[model samples]
Target: MLTLDDFTPVTLEDRAFFLDLYARYPQQHSDMSFVTMMCWNHYAHYAYARVGDGVVIMSVIEGEKTFRGPIGPRDPAALEEVLDLAVREGCAAPYYVFDEETLDWVKALYPGLAFRSDRDFADYVYLASDLDDLPGKKYLTIRGHLNRFRRSCEPVVEEMHAEDLAEVREFLKKWCAWRHCDESPVLAEEKEAVLYAMDHFSDLGLSGLMIRVNGAIAAISVYDDLNPDTALIHFEKGLPDCEGVYKAVNQEAARLLAPDRTYINRESDVGVPGLREAKLRYHPHHMAEVYVAEKTDLEKRHQGRGEI
Candidate 1:
């Protein structure tokens, strides 16, 4: 009997509830993180419904509603109920599966159901050591770029502090101008999302690093623990004034996090060709794959059992 009415909008007040659930469930994807949900809530219109020991998340984007599988202990009955609700109320690609274990169970439930691989949303996860050290021939190009940047810029790296928020904001304005964020709807949304994160940095439990060139902030990376073994970079921005500033911020962040975390999730490329190529160059340890079940596929499965 779970319905849209049972779902509540994601807000700052719900952070603790989500953190608790996520601690117990341990999510693999960045999208499942509470900070991501809150920061992008305006654009995604996120909501959740608590069912039994689990919570089912739903997001409305561009007027289309899509649901993610429950984030709690594996309970087949609870999952089926959510799936039924998604079929009745959600868009074409109604349900998303983030991990392989859930995908396996969902496939078992409906042997004929088809799940589409969402390459655009797949998270690129890299070994912390690989990014921190740049030790092998595979990283020769990146090492060369870093060396060139260091020789040219002599960047001073520092951990971002509370007082740095104002300067960070100014840096973002400059970055937006360089990227022409105002001209692109997607970039504008991203600007808003990152600003929201910075505004609530402490509240969201975020840590970051800034690369300073000539005592001015040129690049910044905001991140937080996604799980015991992984750190997720929520926002990484750099000014084009310094070549390879982006790589500098990225490497510094990885070096800072590598000691404690095993992996660094740079998040998804959102199907951007250039961004995808850039992430692929890092050589991900593995992709935290995302899969979605189409409404037609779910309907067909239900129809086969005369249950729809």
Candidate 2:
């Protein structure tokens, strides 16, 4: 059976393989992206093993071991094997079901499993146009803020270049200092992850915009197309050079990436109150709800939850 020992660490070297596999399957959540697995591997400790024609990814996060996928195509036997490994590892909730569709598939196969919604990690999905346009009365405040930002500082959103790496690093240092990232483990790890993504921008297939105000770099966004119809913004950061700068970079990134894509996934808020409010303000087209499944009688669990 599959086990952690059978898996290998996810790294830059496996980018092409993972991206190709994900392209065929088309993931809805950004957390399952290869870029995410590699960049945050230090904190998330991602590992994977080939399962039939597809692959299975697993990670141990916050002292809990979890499984994200048998990512390419559905293989019942392979999935069963992975699930067994999860239980053997004593994972309280092993499966990290990305959406309802995945949960449905798993349930149809297993017939009796306990699954619970994981609101903390559900991805906020938005129409690419909504972010670019900021239309209607609801967005009036955001639009006004964007306008005020433009009036005070002539902002230019330009394609980030290789030579711009130094400036981006400098900007991150200042940004971290302001946020006191060094004092907190979570922020410190995030800083490390962001730097890794930036450092390997080309290999990671990243496209981003650097927002400059009055000829000085004020904000930057790093992103890539997550699927044929969705683009994912992995990291967006800025100093308090001006309020609403984050919103400006966000809008610009959407405007630039939205031409061919229909949606943009800004990822999860992770139970952060301020973050949840900010993302909610934009009005998501949908939230790709995540669920955690543990080994149990599925029918009983579903009955208790009223067929949810």
Candidate 3:
């Protein structure tokens, strides 16, 4: 029987293996595959799948962030094994959002797995697609914001520099303080990840844009390629002074990173009410559903409601 120990570091050979499995199942989006995220996080935690003669998984448990398995061959037994390994490794509620087939098998294995109807897992909205060909209504909204911003103040957009980190950190500290004491865990981790990305921008495959008004930074945005076809907007923050700074920064980001990518991954929305409303407003091309799974033993610890 295939076991977790058999799982190995994702190498060129493994990418070829996963790519082949992915091509065979075109409905699966292994292209934004968790394995890639594992590799980037440096092989500390991994997700695995049992396929043919081998098992596949990803690793790299940095701080509180992790991706377990989007393991394939959606058999209930195989899914359980993946979850078991995830818990044994000390990952807290390792999760993934996959096709109904995968989710069904997972639900069968854990029985307590609860699913949020939305595709995102945190309190953020993502806007994607080429800025030019964006639907008329969306295009108009963006244009309207930019026009208003143009008239509101002298806005300058420029590539971010390492020197700006101190000011950016200060601005973000103030922005985060607006949240309540009982805020979301995902949001907190995302903030930490964004800070890490900023400190090591080039190494993290990140690039950013900052908006300055009257010689002071007003808004800053950062994004990176999730894959060859998907660019992910990781973080964006605006000063309270600007009326339309957030909208203008996003519009500018789309303009600058275009002509080659098919989509953008704005990450997740943890079902925060206002965030859900905003993401829905973008009319996301579609959402990638995410989920949390626990070992049956660990499952006994919670009330088994299977939430967050």
Candidate 4:
């Protein structure tokens, strides 16, 4: 049986182990990515337990513990162990399913079990071409914004380097000030996560692009490959000094990734209304959906099933 003791905190040392497992399983959601977990470790408190050919991930946020379905080969035994552990530990949400395949597998095992979709956590995935080309009438408004920003700012797009980390940190300070990150707990946590990523930029194998408007960095985007055909943009920030600097950075990041990747995952909106609106304006190709099983629902069906 899987126990809390079997789980260990996620750290840089486990990078190779996770990369190997992820290479075999290939995750669809940004949260499953090793870099995302490592960078946000301070906020999410990620830990994992290896189970057979798979691994079970758990996170503690504000003292609330949650577990995710095992990520690896399709092994019913592994799934049962995670479910049992979640139930025994009394996690409010028994466990989470981040990909459709895992959801289906869980449903197959317990046909009576109920799962709830978390719209706030659903990742917006876009065709790399759509973002890069801004084609058709759907993108007309975005194209106008991008064109106007280019005309007004004459922004120069450059790839981020190790030497640029200091400048990037300064830019982030200005951005945090503009956004009043200190006023909100969530934004403060995000600021910490971003800074952690920047601090370990090279160690995390991250690549990014920066937009310089009149010799000063106005916007920046950091991204890395999530899978063979998908690139995940982990952090993006733009100062309001430029009217459309955000749009410019968005398109520039797409242009940099489109040639090699088929899709770009901008991650979840976390129920932020303004953030959701901005992401939707890009017109996602599809959402990499997420679902969770409530403890009550799990207890109802599997309470007495000693093994499950």
Candidate 3 Cα lDDT to native? 0.58
**Backbone clashes, each candidate:** 0, 2, 16, 0
**Model 1: lowest-lDDT 10 consecutive positions:** 299-308
Whole-structure CA lDDT of model 4: 0.91
Regarding lDDT, does 2 or 3 come out ahead? 2
In model 4, which residue pairs have backbone atoms overlapping below 3 Å? none
Q: After superposition, how far is residue 76 of candidate 4 from its true place, in Å?
A: 1.4
lDDT of 2 by residue, 1-308 (tens): 78778888888899988878877888888888888988899898988888887788888887777776687677777877777777777366777778677778888876657677888889999999999999899999999999999888888889998889888999999999999999999899999999998889888888888999878889999998888999999999998988889999999999998788899999999999999999999999999888887655321344433432
C-alpha lDDT (0 to 100) for residue 95 of candidate 3: 48
Residue-by-residue lDDT tens digits, candidate 1, 1-308 = 88999999999999899888888889899999999998999899999998888899999999999999778877777887898898899998899999898899888777788998999999999999999999889999999999999999999999998999999999999999999999999999999999999899999999999999999999999999999999999999998888999889989999999999999999999999999999999999999999998888877775555332
Cα TM-score of candidate 1? 0.97
Worst 10 residues of 3 by lDDT: 26-35
lDDT of 1 at 94: 93
RMSD of 3: 7.4
User: Which of 1 and 2 is the better model by lDDT?
Assistant: 1
Q: Clash pairs of candidate 1?
A: none
TM-score of 3: 0.63
**At residue 164, what lDDT does model 1 achieve?**
93
Give candidates' CA RMSD values in order.
1.5, 3.2, 7.4, 1.5
Residue 163 C-alpha lDDT in model 4: 98
TM-score-superior candidate, 2 or 4:
4
lDDT winner: 1
Candidate 3 lDDT, 1-308, residue by residue in tens: 44555655554345556556555543233224433343343424444545453344544556443344444454444544555555565456454545566667556655655654434453232345544345677567766767888788889988877777777777667666754312866557656655666666655446788888998778888876655666667677887787889777877777777666666666565566776765565666666665554444445533555432
